[model samples]
Target: MPKMNIKKYTKNYFMPPKIDMSWAFKEYPDKAPVWCSVDLRDGNQALVIPMSLDEKIEFYKMLLKIGFKEIEVGFPAASETEYEFLRTLVERDLIPDDVTVQVLTQAREHIIKRTFEALDGVKNAIVHVYNSTSVAQREQVFKKSKDDIKKIAVNGAIMLKELTEKAGQKYRFEYSPESFTGTEIDYACEVCNDVLDIWQPTAERKAIINLPSTVQMSMAHVYATQIAYVSQHLKYRDNVVLSLHPHNDRGTGVADSEMGILAGADRIEGTLFGNGERTGNADIVTIAMNMAALGIDPQLDFSNMPEIINLYESVTRMHVYDRQPYSGSLVFAAFSGSHQDAIAKGMKWRAEKKPAHWTVPYLLIDPKDIGREYDGDVIRINSQSGKGGVGYIMEQKYGLDMPKKMREDFSYRIKDVSDHKHKELLPDEIYKIFHDVYVNVEKPLALIDFKLDKTADGMRNGTVHLYSGGKEKVLPAHGNGRLDAVSNALQKELGINYSNLIYSEHAMEIGSTSRAMAYIGITGKDGKTAWGAGMDTDIITASVKALISAVNRLQQ
Candidate 1:
């Protein structure tokens, strides 16, 4: 074997010019850039089965609801279905006045004419046109000169201007020098500025000059520099909305988009969950949420994120990665013991003080901010269980606040079960473990009946019927409290001696129920402790049941 000459195959990509790199040092975007979704076009094209007209409309409505003002619906001239979808929107008057439906086309006269025709009767539209001008695209694919490519873009702009005037539609214009990252910056600038010059954009009719990292070439910083240079040098700068269309070939699409925004791009073109050709586009969800985390309004609402993810998955037939930034099923979940403990304590602190910031450990925002509950979604239970998380689950889900030591004790039992079962436990299942093992246990010391009466001296008199030692015994005793009197009666009559009783109680605030829970712990003469839980409407009755549960476990 020839050792394959391992390093011979790869070559360095073309890097952009080394201009001033000041734009790369900004902290973060103070506001969201204008968001344009190409989900219906680029995203749909990538799907194995493109969305039907009905599904596309449903997804469009979702995007509208998410606050996207610009949507590239499809390449209307490419297919009848695409043309029909555009026609349906225009005829149905579904496009809102504030929203602009954009359509993509190559820099060809016939296709640009068909694109405008399909957009007939539309009140607001952005007719987007592009042609590849990268070195590889020009030399390998088109075999055309720079002058030839520039003429294609200039001609497309002229046709758009002529037809839009003829139709009197007042449509917006967007031009992309596709594969802009691979083209020489000076030449790319010349093409974009020429398009702008022909369009003669004004304040009333601003045009968009989109610089796509059609394929990411260099690192994020180099891309930012290129975007910064274009933003600085482009003619008709104020009337030009510099937009970015980044692809994830290098898995840095989001990073490129973020850097580009900082480098003076005014708008972002992406799809929900980054659904596009190749490795997919920059995920608009991530960009928006990242802005939100920094206290900047992302301008897009993802409050009902679960429903959004569900709808996107259903329509796109693409599964969102479980760790996808904000919309994933398990993005906020904590499974490690240390992680769970910090999150549990952080949540506790959040509740106690209602802090002005979201400082919950390992959590960027409240799960409730996205319609997720903290019970199962946040502090999950598994074999790696810790006291803080298990106890948090108990307190949040079922309202059973066990003592600290007892919580520590109970965590081990839950972990043992989870380790054996080889799976994570849901809230109800974890509660079931606590109920089955510790709550209201009655075996050898089953309480058949019990009554308590308060006397004038503030002492409690109690009567109990029990099944102990395989026989039923009746006993009577007195003490300072009802539960104490019951415990005394057991010790005196049944010779069961235990002391150091600990108790706590709380009402279950979840679901439709008036039930209360009581937790009791007792240490016997052997210094062995047993913990028990009971649920009932009456606190006293719940406590009595809990005491018996502890006693039964102690005897065993």
Candidate 2:
């Protein structure tokens, strides 16, 4: 490996010197800002192969369904496909009355004219124009002076105003000082104010002054401070909609967006799942869902998260990572013993208390709110699982509330199986293990029949028939209850010595015809415990069978 020099790099971003830091005093946004999805343009262009026309339309329709009022359809002048997609939306009347479409263009005459030509019959549209304003772009890329770059932006804004007036259209205008993060904060604000002065926007017909962190180079707080400087110093401050378009070079796009909103930005332009240049754009799904988790209505519908993920992956050919926040497959899954235990207890508390708000531990919000189930999405079982998680599965799915000791014993057995198999145990597989190992063992001694009779003293007496080694024997005994009488008979006749028999029973379902299940645990002479279970329609018979099953387990 070659040694690297640390002296070669320098920070290119500049911070505002005289701005108030009041935006930092606020915690978070209490309401959602205006959301603008650039999925069709920004996200598509970065794909290995950009989306087909049909796929683009499908994606556009899904964006509308997700409650986005503003969608940047495409950069129509960039390609024939882009031009056709915009024309198709306008010609087929696919654009909704309440929605406004946005198109991107460079700060030049020919491209701007072609962009307007693509929006011939659109009722509501935003003509987005941009020019690079960062110091590196001026010195290295464009080789133009600061005044020259400012002239490009002012000319673009003048043409957007004149074109709207010439066509008798009430179209909106948006100006972006692209690469604003690497530019001087004061210079960026100056260019945006110049554009605003040309348009002379009113509150009813506002103009958007977008400051894009086109190549995020600093911490999130620096971006917020820059936004505050522009927001406080822009012309027509009340009428200008200050927008942010943050990319994720520093992996702080979402943080920049949230803090920027607190810094007085009014709108956000990004793509679904943050698909764009370099690392990606700001993930609108994450930003909106974060607001939802904070108990604020993001005004976006992401309830069916699975459906949204499916459509996004299908059209964009991008895989949503397994650990993606709130949208990934494993986001709600709990595999560790402690996490599963806490989640199981939290769910039980919710069922018992029915709280007005969601406060489950290890879970920020209910998975059901986003079309995921508790059983399928949460409380996953494996070798690392504990008693609470296994017990929760049994009680929630099978209605068998075993005692604490029995549950601990069962969990060990389950973990042993899972550890040896080196795999996760599904719910049905766990139930099968319980049924095969403990339920209804009719081995060396089998219970063929039993007859119960009440004595004059109110004591219960029973004759339990037992079969072993190809022989059958009927024994009579008396005790305070049927199960006790059966246990006494078995000990006396079969010489199966055990004591401290623990027993419990319940109906599997809530119906008169429901079958009953019973469990029994016995301590052998070696002081170890064995557990068993049985089921029948009659409660007393179920108890006798349970006793027999326990004795059989002890003999084994």
Candidate 3:
């Protein structure tokens, strides 16, 4: 391994002079910016195996369905597949009337001509031309002076105007100073202004000046300041769409995009999930969903997020990381005991109060809003789960609202099973554990039959047939109610005594059969409580069986 040397690296970015920091005072943008998806170009090119023409078409269709008004299909002049994809869209008339397709080309004349040819039959298109403008490119690669670089950009802009006039097509133009972050901020703006001077963009047909962090070289704030300087100094500002195309080399691509938008950039050019060269471009999904979280309509529809994820994964052969924000599989899952407990309580509050806005703890947005289920996505059960989470599963999935003390006891049993297995327990497995271990336990003490009748004084009279200790004994008892009457009979007949009997019952609505569910908790002589549950078609039978189950547990 080579020894790391910090002395060899110096900051390559230049801060714009007298940058207006006023843009930082506001919170996030109140409105959605113009979103331009560069997935088919930037994201696809970064893939190990680029998408085939058919896959590109499918991906483009999904982008359209997501409400993207501008989509950079590909760099047509760069490859045959890229050229054919654009031609196919034109021939099939797949481009919607409101959508404008964009193509990328170098400042070279041949590439620019081929790029325009690819968009020959398109109704609306953006001819995007870029030239490397960074100080590193000037000194190390091209060895060109400032004037020479400016001329190259100027000539490219003039050629685009000439071709549009010759073909009688009103194509909007866009110019990118590639690696703008590493370029002198003033020099980069000067080159862009020269290009705009030739295009003479009008309000009706506005041009785009995309400032890409082609290679991220500074903090997001520095990039925002650079964008602010360019936005202020640009010629024909009203007729230009100041755009951002930030890469994620420092993992701040989304931050740069956000701050740049706040700094006056009006459009964003990014790939889905931030897929691109090097680290990747800004993630459009994250940025747009961030707006949605802030109560701003992002103009894109991601309601069916799972379907979008499936298609993105299948087409790109890239897995969305399980921890990816908003769209990943586990982003909404709560497995920690504390997280699950809070989430469960928050859900209960939401149900009871029915709040107009989302305020669930630990959940930024409702999972149901993105086509995820509460039982499946949130409140996942594992050994780390606690009483509130386990209780929630029982109530939500099975309609068995166990008492609070019983819930704690049941949670221990579940945690033990999961800890031993070293795996997550599904809802059905959780219910199975509850049923097998705690429900209707028949053992040394069993209920053969029982009957209860009301007395003339409004007290309950009861008779229970018991089979215990290898003998069957018939006993009669009376108390305030049928359950109390049964409890008195059990203590007298079986020679067992306990106090503070806690019980609850509800209709089991989640199962196939119409059954009543009952839970019973009894405080033993030691003052510790044992819990058991029972289910039956009749409510009285369910409660009686529950008492017997609790007694069996307590005796054990």
Top lDDT hit: 3
TM-score of each: 0.94, 0.96, 0.97
lDDT values of the candidates? 0.88, 0.90, 0.91
True-structure lDDT of candidate 2: 0.90
Query: Where does candidate 2 clash, by residue pair?
Result: none
- Best-first order by TM-score: 3, 2, 1
Best by TM-score: 3
Tens-digit lDDT string for candidate 1 (296-354): 99899999998998998999899999999988888988878889989988888988999
Task: Tell me the deviation in Å of residue 512 in model 1.
Answer: 7.2
Best-to-worst order by lDDT is 3, 2, 1
**Clash count, predicted structure 3:** 0
lDDT by residue for model 2 (262-323), tens:
99999999988899999999999999999999999999999999999998999888999988
State which candidate, 1 or 3, has the greater TM-score.
3
For model 3, what is the C-alpha lDDT against the true structure? 0.91
Superposition-based RMSD of candidate 1 using all C-alpha atoms, in angstroms: 2.3
